[model samples]
Target: MTTRAFCLEPEQLDWCARLRTLAAERFRPLAEHGADGRLNRPLLAALGTERGLLDRVFPPDGTAASALDLCLLRESLAHGCTEAETALALQGLGGSPLAQFGTAGQRERWLPGIAGGRTVVGFALSEPGAGSDAAALELAATPDGGGGWRLTGTKTWISNAPYADVYTVFARTGEAAGARGVTAFLVPGDRAGLTGEPLEMLSPHPIGTLRFDEVPVTAADVLGEPGAGFGVAMRTLNLFRPSVGAFAVGMAQSALEAALAHADRRTAFGGRLRDMQSVAHQLAEMATRTEAARLLVHAAAAAYDRGDDGIARRAAMAKLLATETAQYVVDTAVQIHGATALQRGHPLEHLYREVRAPRIYEGATEVQRSIIAKELYR
Candidate 1:
């Protein structure tokens, strides 16, 4: 039997050990319940507020956490609860810019609730026409005469849009037409004319589209400089992209575990599945790819923590490799499990669906390739 090896520093290993215990004790039950279409929001809220997991990676002090710490927590949480992983990840993503650049008042108003799980936060950048070409967004934010802004446009494929209390929304600030015109706003979900509708996905979560018909915002809500929305969004992605890889690593780890457990117990050709050279080779390959992906994710996280400008490139690399590798690993696990993997409620089956979205989100594989090419040529 191949025992999964975690590649983490000693301190991160300790943190992961604690996080795993918490996941087993708390999140696992919720995850099992959620499997039957029961999403326990109150339970998640309690975990965030009472258990203190939301603040694990994003501390109150604004000091950067080690990349290993972030990866450890993400992987551990994802192992037991992907919805909780999604919720926690969005908190980090939504509040990250504020942590990086918000005025004290802005941070005071939002960060605590986020850390306490009193509210949900979302990032709204993609539009009907602007996904991979993110800079081509057409959402307009015109300055209102009363010293505020009136946002008008539609954003699609927004994560957490259906339940978010606040959104880090992006829109056009200039007529130049491209990345230059983009600006970001901290739009309250309850603001007038701001509405969202849930989007059904292959793997379910609180994803949706956000519509703004003159949604209002004060200058106080602008995330950074008016023309710096693209930078903020990209910088935020650079910081969290490795964690996406970490999510993939976690899913892959679960799949590998399921496969190995099945292999050890299921007999075939007068021996256990683990005795077959073909199955052992496949398991070896899956393990190798998963570990390699973890290394890439950690290296990118470490680079960001060290304040290295190379983080964007490394993050893109990690996101690309880890998500694709996760797809491969999960598919192999499904094959190893044979008919059992196809059963609707199987853990491997769930992982199969969960692993598909990471490649599409965070910036698709093609976008990452372009990013790598551009960086290499530059």
Candidate 2:
């Protein structure tokens, strides 16, 4: 496989390095200036206008980007500026359905602003009752007398909620049960009866809950066929799952680099930390596991790009291993660095908080395991 070739092409490596530089030089400053737990509009604008990274995800040609490209972009951005990485990821996640399954009018209406970073979007799939079990969503989309539907329910843990200019919402359209009754809608944030409030989270990125008090949606707002929203959601997830792994790998790589730098400098026992056999071995393990996770992420992304069979299994494996590896890598780095790593503004401290969530969100670690097992049986 291309990913197994032992190294990314020279050009690809250069591209990743360039992206990392941009993340540090451009994105990080914007993130630092923004308030915690709030959507950073300036950072979004920088990604869209300055770097045009969002355009890579939602191309104007109405075609989906290769999963490998998404993976590389995410991993590189995440290596330097996680906030920037997140902003880009959320935009891609929310806009993917529109690019893939939306009507002409829908695409024409929304894609431009999304690409330019003037508009923010949210993926409103998770609810209190049905988060990991997405098909069991209860956001009711009842038929109105005028061929439209009225949405009434709550969406929790939504990224960019309450502030996004638009949302891609999946609701129960009652065509059938469990993965069949769902339908996706393109909801304008300013629409009446739809409101949201931010929730306090461990990570600084924006997240909140949305309340739909009979928000009205027209037939024009529906994405793809009625009752096919589950497929739409799954397709989106398949493309992104590996990239989520890439995000983890980026964080892992960052932590590994930090550990290496710290080990090289911090002296203990009359020598540098890196000089100790125990510390040296720990660094080696962190490097090995991080490399393994990176390989898994790249392989899954390549498989997805090729439309290979067992993509679900591969993606699940990548996400599971990489997220778990990131957690271990970050935690170990903190241990090696000791109490100084726990200081409020320490990079490791920020990473420690950030690392825990990837294992929980976008299909938790347990959920990924279930998916892999199910695919293997199939």
Candidate 3:
């Protein structure tokens, strides 16, 4: 039998440790002081300019960061501060299409602000009717006689919406049906007739709904070709999905650590909680599942960096296992901690809220399973 061991190099491990320290010492304070459910410009500027982490996503050399690098970045930061992790991830997600497909003028105009963290960008794809079925987006982009388009529709559940400096907006252009007719545009948030309002979400990240009333966009604003936006979206998602799993793995690891620590110290019936069979077994399960999810996330990211075949299936599996595992581990940790875990400011409580969204965003657990199945048969 051949045994394959998955592991990170000593240097890579050290880098991750440094990232955790940076998040705790530098980013967390800013995140705490910032308003709830809103963008924190100071925290973003630190991640972008001070730490230069955003440069890894939109490098000046035009070389994209490896998928493994992105996964490591997300996981390490998530372990120390989920808010910081979320901010960094949102920057990368919103700006990646521009980096990958924008014209030179677009890149020159927007890349600097994005890297400096002065600009907030949103990926406006999910409409009220098209959250999971993205191809079913109903936002319309009617053509004008002068090589321009007028957008008129709504996009909900958009991160950094209303406050974003710009948005990568997708709208139906009538070239065909479903995804075939969709187009992506780089629309400024201040563009005429563009408006939005913040949403009060469970997770405290800045999410909102955008309403467009015939917002004008010229041909120069298009990302890639007009009818090729879906490909742009898919490529961006493929690169990001594994990192999302990495985020979940980090949260699971944090919860597992808390469970282990609590088990060792807390007193119960005649002894410490670790002495109890039920508590011990629960800790073991949490540890085992967390480790499993971490390894799977790493494997998927490695596959993506290598440009291996069946990336879609691997990415979906990684996200499915890791996010689900995070939810389970966090819930079990909360149970072990008893009433204290449910307190308003408890770490586990915050984690419990944060862990639920990953399974729904990017792609849901059900969606991931479907992708895996389709890929297997293909």
Superior candidate under TM-score, 1 versus 3 = 3
Q: Kindly give the number of clashing pairs for every candidate.
A: 0, 0, 0
* lDDT head-to-head 1 vs 3, winner: 3
lDDT string, candidate 1, 1-378, tens digits: 999653556776787777767776777776666532223466458567888877765687777655656676788888877766776787778777777767788889988887788877888988889888898898998888887778999998887776788888988978356787778788788989999888777755667889899998888998888878888899888888899999999889888988999999999889999999999999999999999998889888877888887677899999999999999999999999998888997888888888998998879999999898899877
Query: How accurate locally, in lDDT, is each candidate?
Result: 0.82, 0.93, 0.92
Candidate 2 local lDDT, 1-378, one digit each (tens): 355574589899999999999999989999999998888999999999777889889876767788988999999999999999999999999999999999998999999999889899999999999999998899999999999999999999999987999999999999998899999999999999999999988878889999999999998999999999999999999999999999999999999999999999999989999999999999999999999999999999988888899999999999999999999999999999999999998999989989999998889999999999999899
lDDT of 3 at 364: 95
Worst 10 residues of 3 by lDDT: 56-65
Compute each candidate's TM-score over C-alphas: 0.94, 0.98, 0.98
Where is the poorest 10-residue window by lDDT in model 1? 35-44
Task: Give the number of the best model, judged by lDDT.
Answer: 2
- Local accuracy of candidate 3 as per-residue lDDT tens digits, 259-364: 8898899998889999999989999899899889888889998998888999999999999999999999999999999999999888899899899999999989
Error (Å) of candidate 2 at residue 154 is 0.6
Which parts of model 2 are misplaced by more than 4 Å?
1-6
